[model samples]
Structure formats: structure tokens, C-alpha cells
Target: MTLNRRAFIGTGVAAAAALRAPMVWSQGRPRVVVVGGGAGGATVARYLAKDSQGQIDVTLVEPTRHYYTCFFSNLYIGGFRDIASIGHSYGKLAAEYGINVVHDWAVGVDRDAKTVTLAGGAVLPYDRLVLSPGIDFVDGSVPGWDVTVQNKMPHAYKAGSQSELLKAQIEAMPQGGRFAMVAPPNPYRCPPGPYERISMVAHLLTQVNPTAKILLVDPKDKYSKQALFEEGWAKHYPGMVERIGPDFGGDKVEVRADAMEVVIDGTVEKVDVCNVIPGQKAGRICEMAGITDGNWAPVTGYTMQSRIDGTIYVLGDATAQGDMPKSGYSANSQAKVAAMAIRGELLGSSVFPAKFSNTCWSLIAPEDGVKVGAAYEPTDEKIASVSSFVSQTGEDAALRKQTYEESLGWYAGITSDMFG
Candidate 1:
């Protein structure tokens, strides 16, 4: 209920005889195949099955049994949360909702045949396809970095073992050592993620290696919650964090994973630990579906349907929806709208106007939280923002603590919404 402005579940019984004849349920019943089990795919799968009762068949195709959310992995890295706390399982979505959850990889999509090919060679026929496979890194965006070298300079972007790897590496750093972070380019998932990671790293270093220094090699001049983060850094841990922007060779950077060196402005420096978050694109499944326009899938603002293929809807970080940041909350919101539209098409359910809302909260230090959010609706061309709000600079302790507490509640609520 707390996220009701962004999520809605509709139910109504109207005789198909009174409405459009084409919308009547077929005898065999329509089948919906959802690829990926992140916020978007999971929420839509649950809603479509639960709201429709037994009117349709829902199958969720996801490779992972337990999903670790990328949203709060930074907090886990910071030691505020344990790894088990952020992990969720798909058992509830299967048993409780009567969904056919398939633990397999969706290798190919046959658009003409309306079927999906799984890794196990089973073919699933679907009336509607929902793809929300999340993000994949652009090849060679970080010089001298690839999947082969991820263990050395882990991105820790995907959560789980990578996050634990990064945490152990950071803790193993020597006293007064240098830790470097090569931030990603614009239009990446979780705009505030890297900065939050920095805050968490700082929080850990302040207690362990008080003399350690953190150097951020950032392409962007400014980051989300810039003023507030800077204020907290200066107040809590001064002289420990430094940012090198593009103007000072932040954009011109490279890494040598084998040698553990970072090249900034043609100057190579040895580092104790390196975190290279590469530029991202839509997940590989999107490309396989032949719906991606460049690195992302272009979608209509009103409904998350692919502009290239109307029968297939794309959601979350994989979509190129205007103005909406590729966050878990945004994906969940988009899934509801797409679910409503899909239900209306197959089950003759009533459709409502599409609306979405999102909020991204970050912790600078313990009990010190900051946020930015907006409510949006479809425009002629994009998902335009109607209104926005952000945490003010130099806020009192009480409000910041309250915000952090609210974020904890949200994390609990959202994971339940997605998994259960």
C-alpha cells in the first residue's frame, strides 16, 4: 500500500458478451511468457496471474533461483545489511500464485511463431511476451577490462558474489593505500549507485584503515545528491575522498587488470583495489528478440510495448523510456501498466490511465540518508515528469534518520511484492 501511487492491482468481472467479441477468452486459454525474474518480470507475472485468477496461464523463465537485488547491494557492501537479507527466492511466486516458474535460460525468441526456445530445448508458446532481463555491460567500455578480468577489478554491479568479492578486496587493502573507482558513463542503471558505494567504502575505511584514501575517476562532473554527499563526507570523513572529473582527465582513463594499474591522463598509478563499472546496454535477451534499437529497446510511453513489436513488452533497465531512470522502482511501476494493458487485451479487463512514480534513496553514512524522486505520466513523445522532490542540503539528523528507516520498510515491501 505504501507504493500504491506507483502500483495497482485491478479486478472486475464483466461479461465478454457485452464487450468486444475479439477480446473474449479463447478456449485453450491465453499463455503469457515472462522472461527474467527481476522487479519488472516478477511483478508482472504475479499480477497477471493473481488478478486474472485462473483465466490465463503464466510462465516465468528465469535462470536464477535466488535473486540478489542490485538496489541495496551497496548497503550490504557498507556492512549495514547482510547478504542473506537482500536475497529472494522464487518459490513463493510458483506455489502461492499458481505460476509455472521455469528455471531455465530463454535463449531465443521466435516472434513469428510466438514461441520461446529455452536452454533445455523446450519451446513455450505465448500470446504475450514480457522481457525485462536487466542490463549487460558494453564491450570494451573500460580499457583492459572484460568478463575474463572481472575477478581482479570487480564491477560489483550485479550483486551477490561480486559484491562479496569487492568487499573482501576492499577490506584487504593496505593502510594508507589508494582505492580507485572508474565510474560508468551516463544513462546507466542506478544513477546514484556508484556514489553510494563510495560512501559505504568510506564508512568501512574510516573504521579500518583510517589513513586510506579513495580516488573517484568520474566521467560526469556532478553526481546525484552531490551537495548532500559532499557535506556528509566533509563532516564525517574529511581528506579521505577525492573526485577527478573529466576536465582533469577523468574521462580519459584506462585500466590494466593484470598489472593492477589505472591510467588517468596518460599517467599510470598502482592501486590496491580497483572498481571498474563499465557502460551498460540492454540485456542480451533483448538483442535476441530483435526488438532493440541500438543498445536498448524503444518503447511507447503510455504502455511499455516495444515500438518494434507490439505483442512484446519491454520493461526496466532494458527499455529506452524517456525521463525514467533505470531503477528497480521504475521497473516495477512500468510492469503494472504493461500488465494492465496485457490483461485488457487477453481477458477483456478494464484499463486505466498509465501513471508511474519513483524514488531513489541513498545512505551517505549511518542513519544519514538523501533522496530524489518524481511522479510522471505519458506525454506525446516521452514519459514526462509532472512534479519532483529532493532532499535539501544540510538537513537535520532527525529527518535523515527517518528517511533511512523509510527506505528499510520499502525494501521489505518491494521484495515481497516482486517475489511473493
Candidate 2:
């Protein structure tokens, strides 16, 4: 039967009543294992621990102790913020919220056994498994780029080390040198991310090497905030940024990381640095769990539960939820909904209708920001956008600065929400 909000809540209430007491007392509180530690996983872990009041045993699995946010990594590259600013520690989740934060790679998930195998030779048993492992690059999406040659091409899409490497490369570029970016196609993590990185790269190059040029080799015909970015590029860094679309064979391309050259439509162009943002799919762990439909894990938006297995939930960039973009803000929003639904099912708590919202902010230049956002509600089919807004092309400077300031506030608020 199709599980809509009412049916889900009704069944949950009945099952929770019968199973809650035995599960809690006999099993020593229902165990919840959350894999991943970024915006979605971290937020869900924190919320489950915070709201459950010790009735749930929450454990978070992540490989990195210091989680680097992909959302604002561009600003770090542009020198608006430092790398440390974008990095967050899982200490608060352990210390403050009483979550068992395991710093280990989750290698496998056994759904039948309800156990997760870690790389360090430990297994975790869970009553509910939340897989929010985020995105992993699709193999050979970019013809000549992979993790082995990442040091040379440097996707820098994951933030932290890659961001530092890309920034260092931009700084070390000789005068009038060329920088190339092979942008990913649609349905990748962070729709506006590549464009924002382009703007930030231009910002940095304009300051250090004014004569340097940027080539955006994009497979998409258009990108998020195209007009705003185009206008800003012309006004702030004129004749510096150039974009090649599919019409011009931008989609037909390959890179030579060894030679630092890009081959576009049989035309080889030498570049000083190449940033290859490749096509992406849900994190590998999702596939290992046998929960993915194609590249993404399909979930019921009403509760973020995997369509294949009701015991498993997926969130963030790894999910195939409709309408919402694969962004940090979107992930954070989805996490809350999942947390609420899980609590209702496990603890017999009240279940409320699911709602979600997201806002994507892009900085074109210093204090020049544009935004797009929407409110969403879960339908039988998907999470549908109910209302939306976007910054106009010719917005005033004061307004743009206000938008930028707003983004800073959101970053602080979200990081606190996720970590604490």
C-alpha cells in the first residue's frame, strides 16, 4: 500500500504502541545508526539525540573528524573566509548531545541483519539506518580525470584539502595564465556551486593576476543565476570570464591532467590550471545498501524513508527527492523531517505533516550576492515547491550586500544547528 502522511502516522501509532515498550526496555533504547556527518547526517543525528531525550541511542558514522562544508567553500577560495571557518568538529555532537560519533568509514550495510560494517573491523546494529552519505563522483564522467590525478586537475568539489589545493594553484598562476573548469551537468550536488566557484576564482585572479583568464567548459546550456553572474563578471571582472556552452562543443570535451591541457571539440587548449567538477552519484554506501534506483536513492518525501526498504532512510544530495536542489540547506531541511518521522514511529510521538524549505545564495563579487529559494510540501509523488523567489538581475547594491550578510548569518546558524 502507498504510505501517505495519514496512513504512515496511523500505522506508526499502532506499531509504536505495541513495540515501543518492549523495544525500549528489553533492547535498551531503540538504536539509530546514522551514516555520514555532513549537513544532512549531522543535522539528523543532532536532532534525534536532542529531541529524543535519551530515549533513543544515536550513533553517527563519519570518516572525517572535521567536516568541511561544500556550501561556502567557494568563499574560502575567494579569500572571503578561511578554510578553518568552513570546517566543523563532531565533538559537540558527542559531548553536548550525547551522540556516539564514530570516526570510521562505513564499508557495508546488511539490511537483513540490521548491521553496518565499518572499515576498522567493527559492526554496529541499528533499529533504523539513516544513509546520508552525500555525493561521490561518477566514474569517467570526465574523460581523463579521476581521483588518482586529482592532485593535478583538482575538482575541489568536496571542500577542505581540494579547496586549499585549488586556491594555491590559482595564487601560483603566472601573469596572464589561463584557468579552466569542466563544469558538471544537471542533477549534481549544488546547482549554483560551479558558477559560484567561477565567480570566486575570477575574484581571486583579478586581485592577484589581473591579466589571467577563466574558461568555463560547461555541458549545460545555462546555469543557476546565469544573468546575475554574467552581469557581475562584466561589471567587476570584464573580459576575464568566458563560458562555453553545448552549442559551442563545451559538452564535447576531455582533459589531459598530465599536460594541463583541455581538449574541446578536437581543439586542444593549454591551461595553467584545471578544475574538473565531474558528474556525481549518491555515495557508494547507498548502493551497497541496495537502496538506489539509479544514481540516487529514492525516498518517500513524507518521511525520507527509502522506497525499497522502510527501515532505511536517505537524505541530502544522495536522495532522489524532487523539487529541492541538492544543496546543504536542502539537506538540512530534509534531515529535520526525517528526524520527526522517525521519532513518531519509534516513540509513539505525534506526527506532523512534512514541510521543507531551501535558499541558495551566490556571491558574485565582494558583498554582491544573489539568492533563490522556495517553500516545499510533500505530495504523494514528491516534495513539491509551493512558492519561490529569486534575486532580480538589477537589484540595488545595498540589497545585494544585505543578501550577502544574510548568507553569513545562515552559515553560522546552520553550522550551529548541525554540530550542536
Candidate 3:
């Protein structure tokens, strides 16, 4: 099926029954405690609550009152959008959908008790647990860089304050100062994110500090939309960006936050600003729950259910599902499938065959956007891609502008779908 906004909405509806009846619960209403109010968790919570029609008790646990989406964060950095524009609140989810919105951190998960312990010392019990904790950086992933030193060399991967920090640092750069980025390896959240960031940074620098230079040290030999970004950078901001791949010691790199220097191979280059996007793993809570395999949580694509524990489901950037990139769109799509499966198991609702889709849009420059996406289905082994599409090179200006506008519409639509 072609998965668009309307098609996505259709996935959230359950097949009609001639005589609808609420399932009887032994211990009050069936409880679903969703940790992380993101694309996955929020969408799942909303769908479960809305589709179940008051049969399932849904609670969302998120520490922050306002969620800043990482998807459009690059635009914020590039001055295309304000921070408030990307920030969403759970008010509608609570007021309209009757969801229990708890602003607290989920500190621990007890698999045996099927309970989640919050940092504020409250324990939440649940018949079903949904984990969509986006991502956390791997410790020592980049030498001399950690959360303590993030103020010196910001990652800005989580959006919000970090994005503000990076943008401010860029704007404050000397006319001809150098800015550097230590891009993450494969299997990172938003495969095209770091590159899009480069494009956005270039866009920012060209207007304010035209002479400034960007040094991108990437471990990967190739990146998402490589040709498109390269073409845009060349066409829009020529002589402003340089890239170092693994052949030139990009893989073997380190950062010195105090000195504001990047050590590529044996060479140390001082930079005005450094954005260090380190290797990533599933949110720490998955490990705490003993549901993670190595750096990620493994789940069945059919229901987004944990391979380790069926009672739990993992979504979004946290899952080790195959084929699908770790993206907000991917998580939102998966949430609907998981929500349907959970409802079916709990309320005997009709569950359709799981269909997943994701499209990643990157703004190359002003009105220059490129995208790649695919439709997916659950096989016995994994979520396999059946078909795909991408923005091609040499596209006319009109089409590129249209792609950028399409992304804006998608951002508005998906955030509404997730929060409302």
C-alpha cells in the first residue's frame, strides 16, 4: 500500500464489527504504560486510546513537557524554522484522548513485576509496556567527549537546547573561522541527518560568515543522498565545505573539547565550533529492562514486540528492525502496527497485515530539498522493503522547491498525528 498521510490515518482504524463490545478486564481496565512521548510512543498511546474507545488505560511518561522534534531541527539551525515551531506538547493527548500524561523520567523497568520505576520514586504497573526512547550516545564513542563536555562540543542531536547552542556557536564564528563535524557511523538515527546538517550549516554560514569553512570527518565511505548533497553543496555554497573520509583517517578520529580541536588521524586542527555526533545505541532503559541485544533492542516487525519479552514492544530509533532506517516517520508507521497488535491481543480487535513506510527529506539549500523512502512489509525474519523512491539529481528548481514544501506539510501532519 502507498503510505501517505491519509493512508497512515487509515492504518490506525480497526476493522468494523457488527456488534462492538468492550472486552472485560479482570484487574480493572487493561493498562498500557508508554515510556517516551516520541513518534513511536506518542502515536502508539494515542492510537491505543482512541481505537480502544476507553477500553484500554493509556499513560505516557516523558520527562519534558514540550517535545522538540529532531526531524526538522536542521531547519531550525538553518533559520528556516523557530525552535517553538518544532516543539510539541502532550496537552491534546491528555485533554482530548484521556491519556494520563506524566512528566517524569522512567528510571528503571522491572520485567518480572511488569512495572516501570520513575526517577521521582513512583512505580507504574502495566499489562503492556511500550518503549520508544529515541537514542543515547555510546560512552567513549568519541574520545574526550561526553555529556559533561557537550557544552564545549555540542552534538545537537536531541534538538531543543543543543540545537540552539550549535546555531549560536555557528553564528558567533569568526568571518573565516573553521567549523567541524564528527559524523556518526552506520545504523545511526536518521541516516541522512548528519549530511542534512552539513547542508544546513553551509546555508547558515554562506549568509553570515561566507568565508567560513566546514570540515566534515565522516567514518562512512558514502552517506545518504550523497550525490544530491554533494551537488547542492557544489552548486549553492562552492568552496565552503571539505570532507574527510576513512581513507584520510576519518574513521580514526578524536576531539579536544577544551582546545576546541578535532584530531583527524595524527593531525590536530583547531576549529571554531565542533559538532560531535557519536555512535548511538537504544535508549538506556532498554538495557535496564534486559531487553537489548548488544547496542539495540531486537523486535519482531509484525507487532514491534520484543524478541526477548513478548509483553514489551519497542519502537522507533530504539528497534533493531531490518531495512527501515531509524527515523521519526518510520517510528510513527511502526507505532500504528504495534498499536493494532496490542489492541488485538487485548480487546480482540481486527489486526491487519503490518505495512510500514518511511521517507527522509533533507534540505540541501533554500528551496532545495531531496528525499529517499520505501514501503515495507513484515517477513518471518524482518521488515523487508518491497519498493522505494528517491529525489533524483538534475531535478528542476520547481520540483526541488515542491519537495521542500512537501516536507513542511509532512512535519506539520506527522507531529499532529503523533501528539493529537
**Model 2 C-alpha lDDT per residue in residues 168-278, reported as the tens digit of each score:** 999999999999999998889989999999999999998999999999999998888888889999989999998999999999999998899999998999999999999
Better of 2 and 3 by TM-score: 3
lDDT of each: 0.88, 0.90, 0.92
Top-TM-score structure, candidate number = 3
Candidates 2 and 3, the one with greater lDDT: 3
The residue-by-residue lDDT of candidate 3 on 1-420, one tens digit each, is 223465555543356322145578789899999999999999999989888888899999999999999999999999899999999999999999999999999999999999999999999999999999999999998888999999999999998999999999999999999999999988899999999999999999989999999999999999999999999999999999999999999999999899999999989999999999999999999999999988999999999999999999999999999999999999999999998888888887777888898989999999998999999999989999999999999999999988888887788778888987
How far off is residue 157 in model 1, in Å? 0.7
**Lowest lDDT 10-mer window, candidate 1?**
10-19
TM-score of each: 0.95, 0.95, 0.97
Candidate 1 per-residue lDDT over residues 338-396, each given as its tens digit? 88888888877777778888889899999998888898889868888899999999899
Error of 1 at 181 (Å): 0.8
